[model samples]
Target chain A: MYSNKYVTIYTLVMTVIVSVLLALLFSGLKPIHDANEAVFKKRDILKAIEEYLPKPLDEMSDEEVLAMFEEQIEQQVLDAEGNVIEGIKADEIDLAKEEKKPVDERKYPVFIYNSDKGKLYLVAVRGNGLWDKIWGTIAFEEDFNTIAGVSFGHVGETPGLGAEITDNPAFPAQFKGKKIFEGDKYVSVSVVKGGVKDPEHQVDAITGATITSNGVTDMLKEGLEIYLPYFESQKKS
Target chain B: MSEVATKKEGLFGKKERKMLIDPLNDNNPITVQVLGICSALAVTTLVSKALVMTIAVIFVLAFANLIVSLLRKGIPKQIRMIVQLVVIATLVTVVELTLKAVDYPIWKELSVYIGLIITNCIVMGRLEAFAMANKPWQSFLDGVGNGLGYGIILILVATAREIFGKGSFMGFQIIGPSADYLIDTTTNPWFSWYMPNNVMVLPAAALFVIGIIIWIQRSRNPKLIDIS
Candidate 1:
């Protein structure tokens, strides 16, 4: 058993060979892994439009999803001033990287889309929820103050509560067409409990999901707050 | 007693029942043994996704076992685990790719969960404990059975959760007014057969359902109970 000079040589050789094999295997699969990730992200974006997707997601063709998104959406990158921030694609902007720089240097990416009603604005937001990181693309109406639509996804959170803020439809849709500003006031739409009685500036918090509703409420206040200055500057112009 | 014993590779013979049924009841990896289930908790809310995950795990386990068995002799004792990981990772990659090309949408839903299968203790558990010392065929069957056992629980939990908790099966309104409600405004007004309980949709529900499954499975078959 103590043949250090004998069997040990075989162990070393085997280790090297196995390590090489692993490298080769990972290299081959890396492309597929990358492709899968890309597709998954694209699919998440498409999920925002599932109601209007015109087919069951599983049965819906990829070409159909792509065609619908392309026909409906146009991408734009804006600065904190609401002026067009050229020379950068929306997806390429890493706010975490930009956060270290001056706010003026940061480019805020926005997505513009159209339905039969009119135009919609999507602002990409990344912030802290309760447990882990939370991210979403919130759409605003042509008026620049009313919310058109919103979608959220998170790394980890209490299920049925914080997580439902992402998975539950009734929760996200509540923000639809809700005014972020109350007529010459930037009070912003609040996530009110029981029900959002104010038809103009409030969305009802999710029933049975309070902490998550609070997460959504706080995240909205904080996330949307970043764009308030830009929107205000645009209105004055 | 025999010289062939020194040369013997497969410590256990490869039989269909041993590989399949062992993990299910006699050697249940989850209930009695209690292993590998981070994903099981979340996906069990819907039968379709849970079923897909089950099949995917089965594919990974069987193939990982077979490969591990084939290479058990060649693997260096020091780096054997790393090799097993490589094989397992490769198999996971293949499964993930196949899912994307064929069923992109469900593949999307399953998302990163597919790659996480590589970390499933059940696959590694069977490969290390039985398959590594067994014949290829035997190891393959064992993987298949264990995967089935896991799937059985997932499907049961998902079916129960989706039908009762949400009132719909596979995201469709199955038990709407057309079925039994049938135009009763006051008595059967807006009856949501499936409210999609925030808890049930979450993975913790899987643990509760699995607990019930073990309780029932053991009560019916006392021998299946793990006293220890």
Candidate 2:
């Protein structure tokens, strides 16, 4: 038998009560968290290819984002061999999980944008960076080789450094119009630490963020390399 | 925290002096002590966002500290930290939910960081060291003081970074609207200062600023030079 004060019944009761309250709190906010994620994903997709969308991003609504994305775009699901994976919905493929699958088994979703110039292809890229993870949507020209626009996001990197992958506008902006394949060997866009004198391939990397710059370069090379066959076949066909 | 606030009611009214200086100089969470620097560096790129986040963090820290101090007697010593965590987490949840309801835009910008406040050492450290043994009123003051202290440094850092970084205070383009005015070296958006020392945008900058603060604080009070 125990003296209740020694047991600290009040403390125990409050603890249980607080824990339940916390459980309820987390449960209640689950929807909001999901909504925030949805918004974030929307923002990412929009930012990935926002060059085509009209400006004043604040005025743009979610419904409009979805509508613009739907009206101006068509999705193609492809297997690693560059063959169309029919009956598999591109929208249904979970991109976050898809990267984990063997490159061949993965559902590679391409957004075919019907722009004024022609069709543009957006490829999703995911890879490990020096700090944590880095991923992006690289929109390609109809040639399926030149980058039209690109946007990247990262996790747990130093701010102003690795986070420059997203926070610094220049990093993402650098990918625009950069050719991924010069002749044959994959020359994915490179991040140059100092202002790039070599205009053909490198974008000036964030100053003092060289390691992060290299991390991004590696991720781009690694993540984008797997999709080369897919793009190459498209180009040839 | 309240009890500790009243601890040495002797010289120069420590409460009065501490309240004014805790956030301003001596015990600053951002500049000097360098504890809660994550939100400061990352979010300061946008002035409005930085301001909103500053206010939210202030609110959360102050209230959470107050509640924890009030309920300190009821918390089991063995599970004291666990109790503090629960309390901080619950308040964070509440702050997050309230943001979602009230200011949706600020909510969108700051919600992720708000949840992260639970990890901010300033809140827990103050609660355990000052509030747990102190009285409620004084603990509340300590929390408010510390949060404000953190906020002041955040605002100063953010204001400096955002204005210079974007050449736009908040969203209003302080610089000329034309593309000619923007600093994009490569192409259109002119992204130079926006790209400078990405360190400025990360939490490390907070550490950098905090180092300066410690230097300033020490310089001011030769007495505080000793190991307390």
Candidate 3:
């Protein structure tokens, strides 16, 4: 039998060994992990313009996505007032963390996917879902008013219900061609229950997912408001 | 103690082979012992998710068993459980990191389940029950056996759920577009009748499927049933 003192010594030695091993393994894998995360975020951004994609999101390889993103997408970090912030990469900013800060202090990322057809402005937004956080990228066309497309993601939501905001293609598809502006007034799109009566400013909410639908509505209204100043400046220029 | 501990068996001997084979059927980790049922329920919603999780568990369990078997003697009696836990946790983390690095899509769908493997009882149960008393080779086989046992049930449950619940296999729609075999949606847009069983998509469905599997498995093998 192992003595108490021996047990303590063995435990300390094993703990030290395990800690060192884990630390080394984590450090060794950090680069690949970071690269994968980068590509995943890029893929999500590209998902916003899935219609214009050369191939479907599932068909395109990570390298292809990274390559397409590198070639066509230009990223800019902007302050609340719409001024471009230098020395910061758009992808590096964590929108969920940024959402917690005051509006003036947050640095917003704008991803512009440019091609011969036109330029699409993708803005990142994050807000509370029924259970946890939900975030997405909403892309705007050259007109800077109508939505080109949108792709939403969630941390955790009720599967088959609230989670359909991401899982169901129809939910996001409705946002296409929907306007963020009602002729010069900033009227962000609403996810209306029962049905969307207005063609421009309203989208159909998921029938069983009122809270998550409302979350999207609130996220769109507030999340897009931060980008208003930037959109206004773009329209003028 | 050393003499009894070092009674090494042949690499592929009968005992060692049984260690690998027994968990698959009569002594299954899921169906017989009913360990690791939580993950089975969580990941079996999709076949692809279940398969990926099974593979991850296989890697973590096999290596953790081998390493623990190798270090069985040196592990202090008072801290043996802690030692086993540390080893399993280390392997699980490595598997998680590798999955994140190489197969990012599977990792995305699997999400927290890979991390949750560390909590799965089968991994710890093998390390304690078999690896502690066996040679490294046999311990490795035991890990493989239990992993496969857990995996088989998961795949069966996932297949049932995916087919009935989602009407799909690994996210591909297996059921024909419409119950009417000749209907073309592009031309008419009004001729489609394939409704997925919403109940099958839920976690409760996994429990039902697992219950059926256990029932069938036990019915065939009366020895697996405990009268006591």
Instruction: Order the numbered candidates by TM-score, best leading.
Output: 3, 1, 2
lDDT, model 2: 0.71
Can you list each candidate's DockQ? 0.26, 0.28, 0.63
**Winner by TM-score:** 3
Give Cα-based local distance difference scores for all models: 0.70, 0.71, 0.85
Please give the distance, in angstroms, between residue A217's alpha carbon in candidate 2 and its true position after superposition: 4.0
Clashes of each: 9, 15, 0
Candidate 1: tens digits of C-alpha lDDT, residues B1-228: 111121344544344545567777767777767776677786777789998999999999999988888877766666567768877877887777778766666786786888989888888888788777876777787788888888877788888777656556776655432343233223455654433355666667778888898888788879876553
Q: What is the lDDT of residue A209 in candidate 1?
A: 59
Tens digits of per-residue lDDT, candidate 2, B1-228, equal: 334445567433667567646666666776556677666766766668777777777777778778878887766677678778878887887887767755565775576788888888888888788778877767677777888888877777776665555555666555432453444434545543343333445555655655665677778887656733
Question: What TM-scores do the predictions have?
Answer: 0.79, 0.75, 0.91
Tens-digit per-residue lDDT, B99-188, candidate 3? 888888778878699889989999999888888977787788889989998999999999999887766788776553433333333344
Q: Interface RMSD computed for candidate 3 is what? A: 1.4
> Which residues of candidate 3, in runs, are more than 4 Å off?
B1-10, B176-193
